[model samples]
Target: MNDEHDSAFDSVTSWIVAALGLLVLVLVWGVIFTFTVYSQALGDAFGLSSLRLSSIFSITTAAFYIAGGTIGILIARVPLRPVVATAGAVFGVAIGLLQISSSYLGLAVVFGLLGTAGGTMFVIVISLVPQWFEQYEGRAMGITMAGNGLGIFVLPPVWVWLLERTGIREAFVVVGGATVLVILVAAVVYRRPPELRAQGTAPVDVAWLRSNLTDGRFVSSLVGFALLWSWYFLLSADLVGILTTGGISRAVAATAFGIVGGVSVVARVASGEFADRIGMRVTLAVGTLLAAVGMVVLPWTGTEPLMYVLLVTFGIGLGAIAPLFSPIIIERFGPANATAIVGVFTVAEAATAFLVPIGLNLLLGVTNGYVVPLLTVGGLTLLGAGLFYRGTAPKTSPQL
Candidate 1:
C-alpha cells in the first residue's frame, strides 16, 4: 500500500485527472453561482417579488449544502467513479430541465436537483484530492477549490453574453447541453486514488461519526465554519445591493464585485501554498481577519478605489476558506472520517446560507442602514476566526 501510494503521488496521469476534476468542479459551480446574475431575469419572466426570487436561490444553495451529508454516506459505501459519473449526469439533466420550466415552482424543483448534484460532486472531488497527494495535499486542494472562485469570476459575464445573444431559455438549453457533455467526458477521466483500490469495500463507521459529533473541537470548528460561510454567502448575495444603496453606481459596484472574484483567484492558490508551508490554522486565521476588516470597512467606502481595496481584502480572505476545509478536517480527524466530517460541516454551512441573508434583510429593515448589519457580520466573522483558532489548538492531554 505504501508503494502504491508513492506511485500515485505526483504521477503524471493522476495530476492530469486531478486537473480535469478541477475543471469539472469549476463548470458545476460556475453554473450554480451564476444564479445571482440570472435571478433578475428569472424574476421578470415569472413576475416574482424580490423576496420570492431570493427564496428560490436560497433553496438551491441549501439543497446543495444539505446534500453533502448524504453524499458522504454514499461515497463511504460505494465506489467513487460510478457515484461521481451519476452525479454529473444528474446535474446535466437538471440544467437542461431549466430550459423548459414554465413556472417558478417547476424551476425551484429543477434547481434543487441541480444543487444536489453539484453538492455531491463537490464532496467527492475534494475528498479524492487528499488521497492522491500526501506531501502536496494543501496545494492540490487549493488548485481544485480555486475553481469556485474562478467560476464566480468567469461565469457571470459568459452568462450575460449568452443571455443577450441567445435570450434566456435558449441560453439555458445551450449551456446545459454543453455542460452535460463536458461532465460526461470528465467523468471518464476521474479515477480513485491508487491507495484505496486494494481496500475492497469501504465500511461506514457510524460510531466514529457519533463520537465526532460529541467532540468539543469538532463542534467548535463547525460553528466557526458556519459563521464564516454565512458571511461568504451574505456578501455574495448582497454586496451589489449594499453598494448601490450606499450611492455607488451600478456599473461601478458590479465591477468592484468582479474584482473581488479576480483577486480571489490569486488568493486561493497563494494561500494554499502558504498553508502547506506554514500551517492551515494560521493561514485560515489570517484570511478570516482580512475578511473581517474588509466587512467592517465595506459600507464606509465612498469611492471606487476604496471599494476595490475593501473587496480585494475581503476576497483574498474569503478565498482561503474553501481550500482549508478538507486539509483541516484531515488533520483533526484523520482521513478515514474526513469526508463524513466535511459533510456535516457542509450541512451547517447550508443552514447558515439559508438564514443569514434573511436575517440580514430583517436587520437592514430594522436599522434602515447598512452600517449596523455590515458591522454585525464583520464582528461575527472575527469571532468565528477566534473560535477556529482556539479549536485547532494543540491538545494538552487526554481528557478522560
Candidate 2:
C-alpha cells in the first residue's frame, strides 16, 4: 500500500515538475533570444552604435555558456532548490540594476550577470527533470525543452507589444519581476526524486572531468556533435542571405527562417518521443543526416516551396539536438555527471555558435558565393555523424 501510494505521488509530482520546467525554459530562453528587440530599443534611446549594442549581447551570450559550465562544475555538491532560488534572485537584482542605470557600461555588466543567472538556472532545471523518471525521461525532457523553441516563437512578438506600450525599462521590470516570482515559487515546491533521497549526491571532481576529456570516445563525441551542430548557428546567421542570393524575395526568405523556428518546436517534442523508442544514437544520427542533406541542397533552392522544404528539414534536425543533449550525456556518464558534462559541452557549443558563423561569413566574402560555404557545412555535418556514431557505441567501462 505504501509502495502504491509513493508511486502515485511520484507520478503526480513528476508531471508538475515537467510543466514548471517548461514554463521556466520558455521565459528564460525567451528573454535571452529577444535581446534583438531590446537592442533596437536601447539604440534608439541611448544613441548607441550597432557594434556597442552587439558587444553587450555577445557579452551576455559568452557569460551564459562559460559561467554556466564553470559554476555547474563547482556547485555539484549543492542541492537543487537553493541553486534555482539563487538564479531567481540574480535575475531580479540584475533587471533592477538595469532599470536604474542608464550607462552603456552599466548595462553591459548587468546583462552579463543576467546571462550567468540564466545559464545556472537552465542547467539546474535540466538536471532536475531527468531525476524524476526512469521510464519516460525522454518525453519529459522533450516537453521541457520544447519551451526553447516555443519561447523563440512566442515571446518576441509579446515583447514587441510590451515595449510599444510600457517603454523599454518598464517592460523589462515587469517581465523580470514575473520571472523571479515564478522561479522562487518553483523552488519552494520542487523536490528530489524519492529513489535518490537516500543516496549522497556525486561530486563532479577535476580528476573525473580530466579522465573524460582525455578519453578518445569522449573527445570524438564532443567534436562530432559540435561540428554537426554548427549548421544551426551557421544557417541562423546566413539563411536569409542564402535565400536572397538565390533570387528569393526578402519577405519569402524571412518566412523560410520563421519556418525553421516554428517547425523546431514540434520537432523537439517529436524527437524526444522518437529517441525513447529507437535509442538516442540512432535518433541523433538520423537527425544529423536530415539536416546535412538540407544544407547540401540549400544553394540550389530557387522557389519558395523548395526553401520551405529545406528549412523544415534543417529545423527538425536542429530541434532534435537540444532535447537529446542532456539525455545523451546522462546515458554515457551517468546522471551524476550529467550537469557537469552538459556544462562543459555547452561551452563547446557556445564556441561553435560564436566562431562558425564568422568563418562561414568569411568564406562567403572570399568565394563571393553561398555554394562553397553551404557545401562545406554539410560535409562537416556528415563527418560529425560518422564520428558521433563511433564514439557512442556501447561500452563496458564506467569512465566519463
Candidate 3:
C-alpha cells in the first residue's frame, strides 16, 4: 500500500511539473518572438525608422510595469482562467486585427495596445513557477527559459518565410491566429498548485514587495537588468537589418536570426542551470560581459562570413540575459515577492527599451551607421558589469 501510494504521488508530481513546464514554454515564445516579429513588420509598413520602431512596441512593454503584478493578483484571487484567457484574448485579437491595419495608428493600436496586452500574459506564466517547485524554483525557471530559445530557434525561419511570401500583414494573421490556439492551451495548463493555495497566506508577501523595490541592492539589480534588456531587445528589434547592412544577404540574415534563437535555446537553459548550481551574482555578471562583447563585435567584423559567425555568437550570448533576471530577484527577495519585484524591473527595462533604441537612432543621425551606437552599448555594458560587481562585492568593514 505504501509503495502504491508513493508511485501514484510521483506520477502526479511529474504531471504537474510537466504542465508548469509547458505553460512556461508558451510564455517564453510569446516573450522572445511575438514583439520582435511585430517590430520587424511595423518598421516595414510605416517607414517608421528603426528608432521609432521601439515606440511601436514600447507601450506593450510599458504595460508590464502596471500589469505584471495585476496578473499575479488575478491568478492569486481567481482560478487561472481569467488571467490566462485574458492574455489569450490580447494575443488573438491583436493578430485578428492585423487584416485591418494600414497605418501607424493601427500599428500603435495593435502592437502597442494589443501587443502590450499579449506581453503582460507572461508575468502570470512566470509567477506560477515557484508554486510548482518551491525549493527548486531557480532550476525550474532555468528549465522554463528553454521555451524562449525554442521560440527563437523556430520563429526566425518561419517569420522570414511568412514575410517573404505573404507580405507582413497576412503573416500577422497567421502568427496571431496561431497565438490564440497556444494561449488557450496556456490558460488550461498554468495554475498555482493547490498545495500553495491551501496554505492561506499568498506565496509571496505584499509587505516585502514594498520594501524590496526601494532597497539599494535590489534597485541596483533593476538598473543593471534594464541596461542588459535594452541591448538585448534592441538586438532582437534590429538583427535582420544589422546583418544585412554588414553585407550578408536577407536570407542569410534570417538564418543568422535562427542561429541566435537556436543558441539562445541553450543559453537560457544553461544560464538557469548555471545559476542554480552556481550563484545569481556571478552568472549575471558573466552574461552581461558576454553580451557586451557580442554587441561591440558586430560592427567591427568586415567579411560577410565573419559577420555571420560573430552575430550568431552574439545572439547566443545576448539571448540568455532574461533567464537570469528573475533568478536575481528570487535570490535577493525570495520567491514570494518575485513577481512584483520582477514586474517593477521589467517596467524599468521596458522604459530603457523605449529610450535607448531611440537614442541609438539619434546617434545614427549624428554619426551615421552603427559605430557610435555600438560604442555606446559597449560602454553601458561595461558600466552595468561594474555596477553588479561593486554592488555584490564584500562590504568592507569601516576601518577602525
Candidate 4:
C-alpha cells in the first residue's frame, strides 16, 4: 500500500482530479438516466410496446454492468487517459446515432454500445479512488459517487425541457455533443497517484481472485448486493412509467423522479461518513431496509405528497449503496484487487439487471397493476438486507 503521508493523499491536485472524474461520471450517467424521460417520447414515436422499449434499457444495463468485469482488467493494465477518452468518444457516438435510429433494432444496438462505454468509464474512475486516498477513502468515494445522484437529479428535468423545445432528435444531438466535450476534458485531468504510476501496473493475481470468489461469505455478499441492485434497476427504469400510469402528469412524474436523485445526493455522502464510523455491513443493511420500506409503500402512494415521501425514503437507500460498493470490496479484498473484485460483483448485478426489468414488465402485463411486482421487489430487498447482515463474517484470507 502507498504510504498515508504521500503528497498525493488528499492533495489539492488529487482532489481536483477526483472532482473531474466525478464530473465525468456525471456526464456519462446523466445521459443514461434521461431514458426515463425519453421512454414516453420514443414509445409514442415508434409505436412500441412497453415490454419492447424496456428490453432496450434492460439490455443496455446488463451490458453496462457486465462490461465492468472486462473493463476492470483493462484499467489495471492500460493508462487511464486513453481508456477514458476512447470510452467517452464511443459513448458520444452512440448517443449521436440515437438521433438517426428509425427502428427498434438500431436503437438497441446503439444503446448496447453506450452501455459498454458507460461501464468502462465507471469502473476506471471508481477504481482510482482508493489509490488516491488512504485515510479518507470512504469520504472521497462518497463525494465522487454523489455525482451519479447529482446527474440523475439535474439531468432528467433539463432533458424534459429540452425535449419540449427541440424535439427528441435534436435533444439527442445537443446532449451527445455536450457529453463528448465534458468527458474528454475530464479525461485529460484524471491521473493516477504518483506512487501508483511509479509502481507501474501490477499483474492481477488470478489465484487470489478465484479464492475470494469461492469464499462463502464473499459469494453471499455478492448475491445480497445483486438483489439490492435488482430493485434499484427496476425502480430507476420504471419510476416514471408507474407514476404516469397512475394519472400523474409527465412533468410532475419527472420532477418526482428527480426528487429521488436529489435525496440520493445527500444519502450517498452521509452514508459514506456513517460507514467510515460504523462499518460497511451495518451501513449496507440499514440502507437496504430503508429501500425495502420505500418499495413496499410505493404502490400505495397515490397522492403527490405521499409519492414524494416514498421517493425520498427510497432515494436515501438508492444513493447510499453507490459509495459503499468500492468500500466494501476494498475492505474485504484490499485496494490491489479492488477494481476486479468490484467488477465481479457488478457482473452479478448485471445478471439481476438483465432479468428484473423484463420480469417486472411481464408481471405488469399479466396483473395490470404494479402492486404484486413492487411487493415482490420489496420482499427481495428485505432478503438482501438479511443476507448482507449475515455475510460480513471475519475474513479468512490475507489481503493480497
Which model scores highest in TM-score? 2
Q: How many angstroms is residue 201 displaced in model 4 relative to the true structure, after the best TM-score fit?
A: 5.9
**Model 1 stretches astray by more than 4 angstroms:** 1-7, 40-53, 197-206, 245-247, 393-400
Write candidate 2's Cα lDDT for 290-380 as tens digits. Answer: 9999988989999888887888898899777777767776667666645677777777778788888899979988999989998998999
Show where candidate 3 strays beyond 4 Å: 1-81, 90-113, 134-139, 155-178, 193-210, 237-255, 367-369, 386-400
Look at candidate 3 and tell me the lDDT of residue 232: 68
**Candidate 3 TM-score versus the reference:** 0.73
Candidates in order have lDDT scores of 0.75, 0.80, 0.62, 0.76
RMSD of each: 3.1, 2.6, 5.5, 4.4
lDDT by residue (tens digit), candidate 3, 1-400? 1334323322345345445554445543654346666566667776788767766656655555445544544344456656677777876777666668767777677765454555556665555554455345555665666666666555656777887887777876776666666767766655545543444444445665567567666666667666766566667567677777777678867766667667776676676667767775677778777778777887766567787677566655654465655655554554444445556666666677677768877888898798778878877877866655554443352211
**Which ten residues in a row are the worst by lDDT in model 1?**
194-203
Write one digit per residue (lDDT tens) for candidate 1, span 8-102.
67666557656866786777777777887877777887788988888787777777888755676557656666777787788777767777777
Clash pairs, candidate 1, are none
Shift in Å, residue 63, candidate 3: 4.8
Give a tens-digit lDDT track for model 4, residues 182-257: 7788677666676766666556668766777797777777788788776787876688888877676778887776
User: RMSD of model 1, in Å?
Assistant: 3.1
Using TM-score as the measure, what is the rank order of every candidate, best first?
A: 2, 1, 4, 3
Candidate 1 vs candidate 2: the lDDT winner is: 2
